[model samples]
Target chain A: MTQTAPRPTLEAVAERAGVSRATVSRVVNGAHGVREALAERVRRAVEELGYVPNQAARSLVTRRHQAVAVVAAEPETRVFADPYFAQQLRGISKELTAHDNQLVLLLTEGREDHARVGRYLAGGHVDGALVFSLHLDDPLPALVRGAGLPTVFGGRPGWDEGLDDVVYVDSDNRGGARSAVRHLAGLGRTRVAHITGPLDQTSAADRLAGFRDVRPDTDPGLVARGDFTSGGGERAMRELLDRCPGLDAVFAANDLTAAGALRVLRERGLRVPDDVAVVGFDDMLPVAEESDPPLTTVRQDIEGMGRLMARLLLRGLDGEAPEAADGAPVPAASGVILPTTLVRRATA
Target chain B: MTQTAPRPTLEAVAERAGVSRATVSRVVNGAHGVREALAERVRRAVEELGYVPNQAARSLVTRRHQAVAVVAAEPETRVFADPYFAQQLRGISKELTAHDNQLVLLLTEGREDHARVGRYLAGGHVDGALVFSLHLDDPLPALVRGAGLPTVFGGRPGWDEGLDDVVYVDSDNRGGARSAVRHLAGLGRTRVAHITGPLDQTSAADRLAGFRDVRPDTDPGLVARGDFTSGGGERAMRELLDRCPGLDAVFAANDLTAAGALRVLRERGLRVPDDVAVVGFDDMLPVAEESDPPLTTVRQDIEGMGRLMARLLLRGLDGEAPEAADGAPVPAASGVILPTTLVRRATA
Candidate 1:
């Protein structure tokens, strides 16, 4: 016990201001019917007494918690391993903090925790939710909808039914992938191959789609599957090399995969750009910049996307139309898709 | 907008249960005066109506929010760049979630946000707080104490005054550093050097102290300053090399620094272990295992420390003495310090 003084109560403030408790409550709650002179006296008394209102009591009257739940249906290990989640959380925290709202993080480990999350959301502990459910089979999006809370998804959700009414923020995955492959093509690489991330995730699936849009007629042997890990990238790169020995370029789903591919190419005594031009997505600084020859990859504004999601949800909560970063009104359902850029580096 | 049904109120449940609203409140709040028969009837009514108690209203009675605030006074960029914070958060989230408590993350950007954090803690929004203030000069601990909220620190706080009354959980940083240096010495590397992280952080200071414990009379020229980044490691390594070219071994403050040292050593045409054996603290998987020859380093149970911090706070909230991981009662003020291990790898 650090000898803390007892908190001042509404009654104490009312007494100091020479007003009824009801009048003080009305003034503090910002109720419009209160007279200005009485409210001014109450405010002065509150300042003098250093009175801080009880959040629970205030929330009861306003029906607002000044909090938003950030729900992510991913194992703790995965969420912590990747920097993508960290960047997005930073964006959400900044946006929410600016509005004086708290970020209540709800991380679910597996299917068993989904019910708990749903119940928490429906419990009205937060005004809205920002959900990140990357996998196509993830049940989180549906469960969140069942909670009937105002929510903005972190990425374009995989669900089909009722998706037209859902709001989301996503990087232009397909467009970014196209730009990467096009860069390789322009460099005169005819035997360009693709290494895909787990197809279960929408980002991975969309990147694979973009690869197809460019080399639709290419042999299927040029495509190898990876799980977006360095180890997975190594295995996929080996498989690609064994299947298509003449491949002159490789486009990996993300930077980690690209790093793995780079290591394998180095072990095989192949020179980057000279023998095999490699490009990756995400351009995650530590990975992309540290890879051998560095990585020429697609750079997505991950933090910007997170900020946009929070902004959209906050705007919707305020009964205003959702706006994109440029302040242009967007269709609520379509949400906003931030563009990505191709960052050229030594590898390509 | 999503056709959500209006929430069933306490009055509605009370009417259905054939009891007064006061009785329903007592029953739901687990107040002992309520008869079991009436409590059962109220419970049945609650279940049938799918009535989720309003958190705000319920909190007004119990004075418990079932939530804990995690305040980290680090800029978002720095916090995100390091995996340490993420791992700790995961551990805290797991322990808190298992207790049916929500995690309210409060990240401060700079000194400007201190007042806001202090006010929020004092606002009675959460039951307690878990603070991570690594720097010695950080004002968060004082602010948190001023708020008079029950708090547990994530790391060993650097403050001296009234520290005996504070509860915290931390890794054995000094012991870990000692092990890393001892291993290098056992390998017969006598001319060893050190690269230190920012001395402002207690962890960095403790590690530097540990290095001195093993080599108390070592020349000052063998030690160089680093900020726990690869670039910092590179610059520090260059300085150490310029100052003590005959040094046979180098101990880095962390894995990122070790990775940087390895790169610089390679560029300087020095063979790791053969020419200059290297050891790093924090066997951070991505950096340690991914380093050129893989880094041999000290491994601290970062996530375990987070879990212990939450456990200590939760136990304190329950009016019980804090206990260490081994189930022995610990002095409240001394708190708990988890042990670390030396992980053998190629670099050393």
Candidate 2:
């Protein structure tokens, strides 16, 4: 990095504009104080000759690439393809723009790409990092911190105990699952089977755990593993139907998986709600609205989770305490465990 | 730019490994380098930090961040919400990783944040930029070009003649739209009203032009403008029904818009193929599999377009000529216009 003359000092501008250094500083540095006309003149004068003051000019300032990095430990296609990603990104993008921060999305597609991602994230490539769709054993959390960068996770992260300070926003998965199971039981479906998500994810594990906690007498034989994917759910459904044809109830971990199960059920010529009462989690809007017999699901407040994630990262980036932004209407909640309502649709 | 010391040159590494200088250079650059044994020793010696006579240290090579930025000018929600973004992203992410480059995604949500986007693209924040979904007359193309950034447009861009050097990858909208029209026409439907997207976009203009090209005598008055959104499509459909009540067919610019048209058509108590022979563009999986009557429409080569966009940018980043990579065994075309097929569904 070559050294050049300090970018036209605000003090030099103060003298040139014949105004107080405070006024020149306010206008040049984009602080909120000086009047509009005076600020305009200072800005015009500053722009006459090239000047971009980085750090050394002020202590009160924060580093503003005006960009944040959103890294996915998964493929970019899956992250971008999922409506959930879109919904979450919408929230983060909207909030970041409000704070004048741009978002940089990065996908660590594989091992070599992962190292590259680590270096980029470490090399001041972004103001901060937003990590999503991480598995329980992903080392990225530690790698990001080891690089001395502030990082936040989009879901209830399954990091090791050492990462107590790592910030994350998650839905109330256990409660959501517990309630869904109770809804099925209330419907008097005797043989309830659980289609769970990938075991490496906390949401998947927690939801299953919550279901068990609600129905302690349930047979462990009813459990099945899904990768939170529609295909996985479809295959899992086929397996469950083959093994336990007499099953009367099924609770899918996610709406996509649930929809797949519904398809299988329809193909199998099973009458939904009557033959097999089913309830899904994460009542995605498209899924809820479009299904053959509209799906009944437990809703998660994804937008709220996204906003809280942004706020937490903003606070961390600002070196502020983890407290929610002062009376300035803190987004919904700090680490929101938003309630999941059981929408009683035709499925259950 | 001042010349630094002549560190170990490629010649020394060749001599050390008993190989040609070209082989040493290839190994050092991580190209399809020399065989593993010689490559290993070269790497080992480089890691030892003792050889400086003929080979530059890896630290110099490490300076290349190997990261490119994908700048989606629309809001985060729009990019993520659209399945197209996810599909294209999957393709780009896969290709970039294969070439050992990291893909960074940037969201330029508003006009003001766009300036910051320019800086991020220019400041070596990334080596190249991939832009998708820009409005017709946005300044980003010119701004990035002026910043001396290698950029690619995910779609055939609208305006910005000066930025023609910015390579673009888009589906064959014209052919796709024409095929869709022919499908409707083959179905014995006349009086098709085109619900076009915003006039500024090439997609919108091209689709409308294609429809007219197929049937020029069809009433131009039946056309209505939509913002490539469901709500806008619904409104456009209503307007078409009110203005051209005799219309028998409707072609929407995208599936989201088509879904909207379906909603409005359903609300108006009109039968799908009997009353309005509706067709859509971009045979997105969700729309094709889920739409009411399983919408009969055009399908763009989304994944292929994404890979080509990334490959074009990668070539640019390497200071190589920009060329399309259409998932061909050996890319046969530069101006690749991917073909589209009309799937006969219940809609048309």
Candidate 3:
């Protein structure tokens, strides 16, 4: 979700008019009880202007659109191929329905479409925005903030940079990876090679950091990088096998990579767990079931995360629009962090 | 996705102005070059309130909002359980991203929240809408149509009711199921059982009808039922097997159910493809691979269906709002059925 700046309201008009909000509301509502001269004056001015009474907006302000737009800053093919996108979406869809909010999925797959998305978010298109796979150079954050709409994101760059409190809901990659490595060490595996996801993502970087944090004595070259994909995993595994044939265990950053490593190992005539125990992260169900023997991996409750993201944004929407309250200071934007865990299965 | 109504635009206003469209545009946009006296008169009349036009919106009119909301008129739990959503989301996201359009997702699960959904759609928060699921009795189709936004449904309901031209994109369930049954009969399987999904959904009903259409000679009692879930399939299979102990083959509506039946047969100490050859539908990759021997099934690209829904809605946004064009006729809500095929594997 992007950080929404603030929605315009009658209260803002009241502040600008140097009058009580109730008085402005009364004028906007067209109540007849006001002083005749003032009522006539307000009516004439309001006629010279278009203003929808609160009746048109009150229910809309609180009612569930039951839909939230999923604005993606990634390409179409990449978005579909991403297993993470599917998992997160499944989780988000589950959570929203539970909350009685439906998901409106959208993507800005090309750079040309970026400006259009900024305008869309600002133009009252969605109740709130769930932004995904944003690049560092993306302008959506600034644009959404300028528009003052409620927003959330899968991952964000920083909090104190351009905006005050941008909400970012992300995986506990560091902790999950640390646990995976600890589990391997506990099982007495001395030579464990790691399959790392792409270095560009914080998720991939954090996982690699956590693995080394737990194994300070490990050889740096043992980390064979992959692109968090099955094909990447296969390529990385073959490289690792050639570089460190004595490696007794492997922990790929995600299930797809782990699955790829398993296929390669099977072709290389190695027995899982007996010859080279393997573990994967993001315990995608197939990763557990499809390995010659099922995989031992870290499991993240993706649906729960989606639900959390929705609730957090809903909580954000629960506040009143930033109205001038007798010239008081600005209110604080709340921030939250969720917990993660590891699930042990067959491969390890 | 449901087809939606047309939007209000500056051109519509200009056409309503009874003046040259450029004159109306100049008056609405507050061009300083206009004659002062004429500007005052035009401003007075325009402000007498056709609609509110902020500086940003003055260029467009009533305003585009530049966003679309998706309301899946189903429980969130159901949305998460199926893979169709992830696929559809991919498609919708791809197209919307191409246009830089914001997509909002919403689900209506609880009773209190369900009531709130309609107001949000009508409140002019979004320029258009997309609906993922529908019951014939659902008030959303009417509410969305009444709000005057374009809509598309992921699948069509059994009856269109008042929404005569509600645009919907769906897969050819009957055709797919017919092909599945024909494949089973062609294999020389004499006694076959069919597992069907929930009857409320047209897909489930049509698939069951397709199965019957192909094999009228099979016992009517062989039609067991599941809710597209593995657990449901297991229970349905228990009933079918007990009722028809002599059955030689089974066709489960989806892979999840087929997997469930496979488990039950294994538990009952029956051999697959020998005592009972089994087939399934929706060849989603994971479940198919994990079966004792991969299962043969009908394949539907749920993701592709989702993408098409996005495409249809995007097409509608191409030119003058459908209402103004005679050829398009707001594209009287139509239905689209995608193709499906049978994928052969070891189980069948």
* Chain A agreement with the truth for model 2, given as TM-score: 0.77
State the lDDT of candidate 3 residue by residue for A1-348, as single tens digits. 999655546656544554434344445543222344544554554444444455544443344455576766776556656666666776666555555554656555566676766665555445677777545556655655544445777764433452323566766778888989999889999998999988766678788988998887888668899988889999999999999999999989999899999999999999888889888988777656776678888887775556556655654554432322223232333333445677766788
Candidate models: Cα lDDT each: 0.82, 0.73, 0.68
Q: How high is each candidate's interface RMSD, in Å?
A: 3.1, 1.6, 4.4
DockQ preference between candidates 1 and 3, better one: 3
Q: Would you estimate the TM-scores of all the predictions?
A: 0.67, 0.67, 0.63
Q: Best DockQ goes to which candidate?
A: 2
Off by over 4 Å in 2: A1-64, A110-112, A175-195, A212-219, A222-280, A286-299, A321-348, B1-63, B160-164, B171-195, B210-299, B321-348
Clash count for each candidate, listed in order shown: 0, 9, 55
DockQ versus reference, model 1: 0.19
For candidate 2, give fnat to 2 decimals. Answer: 0.86
Q: CA lDDT of A306 in candidate 3?
A: 62
RMSD of each: 15.6, 15.3, 13.4
Q: Pick out the ten consecutive residues of candidate 3 chain B with the lowest summed lDDT.
A: B322-331
